[model samples]
Target: MAGVYDFTAQSLAGEDVPLTRFEGQVLLIVNTASACGFTPQYKGLEQLHRDFAARGFAVLGFPCNQFGGQEPGDARQIAEFCETKYDVTFPMFAKVDVNGSQMHPLFNYLKNEKSGLLGSSIKWNFTKFLVDRSGRVVGRYAPTATPDGMRKDIEALL
Candidate 1:
């Protein structure tokens, strides 16, 4: 079966990053938006990244504009907003569709590995998927689920 490491994504900087680069690390993959209410979660996600990076964990952010058109910025704009507003230091990817026919392949794999409350289709932005060190999807979190609330799960995997 395919795992997270089988895919590649474009970073905000336009580099094509192979997910294999993060193979041995626990990862928190989140669909993000700059103008959404859950935007503040970036801070908590960054905290998670800082607190656990030395322990081989990372928070990977993917900007998605599919939900209410909340993240309509270009790559440079998104990068600037995340850095200036939230001081986000975690790795972030370019904008991609999380639902419908145009959905990114990485997201397709993630949703198939762990379906959400509404089934395989994501309901909104900030949806998070937790992957273990072995590249298996271990947990799926809703947009409303706070990053702080997920600490125990993350710690257990770490």
Candidate 2:
């Protein structure tokens, strides 16, 4: 895929969702893991979404189990966990690998567009990629970077 709009991923409910749906919105695409150390970041992500969604901003979460099997749950379980624990209102996709040959196309494009400190491959869960309204990759944040820490950049995009 050349841009964010050229990709599609399965939603948490197993529906194929096209990235084109968010074409004109500033997006924070994150690889999430329910059992990871950064799992609590979901709350912050939800907060960001709630705070900026009215301004054409969104946070898209993609669950991944590749890191220590941190997100070892089915779609329904993950959905319930996110809703009950974090009260997440943003869209979340199904568990997917953010690295390796099996990585989702959207992630593959994101990694290639904005490589991390060392390389394009994701180091762990919770790594975030910021995309502009035009489907352009703007920034890549490490897994350790808290969701709240991205406010400044997200605000700039908005």
Candidate 3:
């Protein structure tokens, strides 16, 4: 894909949503895991979404199980966990493989656009890719990166 808008991912509800729907919004796309230690970051992410959504910003969560099977839940379980535990109201997509040959096309484009400290491949669950309103990958945050710590960067784009 040429950019974020050129791809589409299945949502938690199983609908294919074209990235073009978020064309003019700054996006923070994360490969999430419900059972991971960083799972609690969902709260911070939801807070960020509520805080900046009016300014055209969004946090897109995509569950993954690549790391030690941290996210073992199916779509229903994942959605329930997020909504009940973290009160996550941000957009969430279906689970996907972020590494290896099975990696989703959207993630492939994201990794190629902005590589993390180690390399182009995503390091683990919760790894975040920040995209600008124009669909350019502006930042790649590691799994350890907290949502609050990224506020400054998000503000810069806004």
Clash count for each candidate, listed in order shown: 0, 0, 0
Of the candidates shown, which would achieve the greatest TM-score relative to the real structure?
Answer: 1
Which candidate tops lDDT? 1
What's each prediction's TM-score?
A: 0.99, 0.98, 0.98
Model 1, CA-based lDDT? 0.96
Give all candidates' CA lDDT scores: 0.96, 0.93, 0.93
lDDT string, candidate 2, 79-102, tens digits? 999999999999999989988879
- How big is the positional error of residue 9 in model 1, measured in Å on the Cα after superposition? 0.1
lDDT of 2: 0.93
Candidate 2 has a TM-score of: 0.98
Tell me which residue pairs clash in candidate 3: none
Q: At residue 141, give the lDDT of candidate 1.
A: 96
Error of 1 at 130 (Å): 0.4
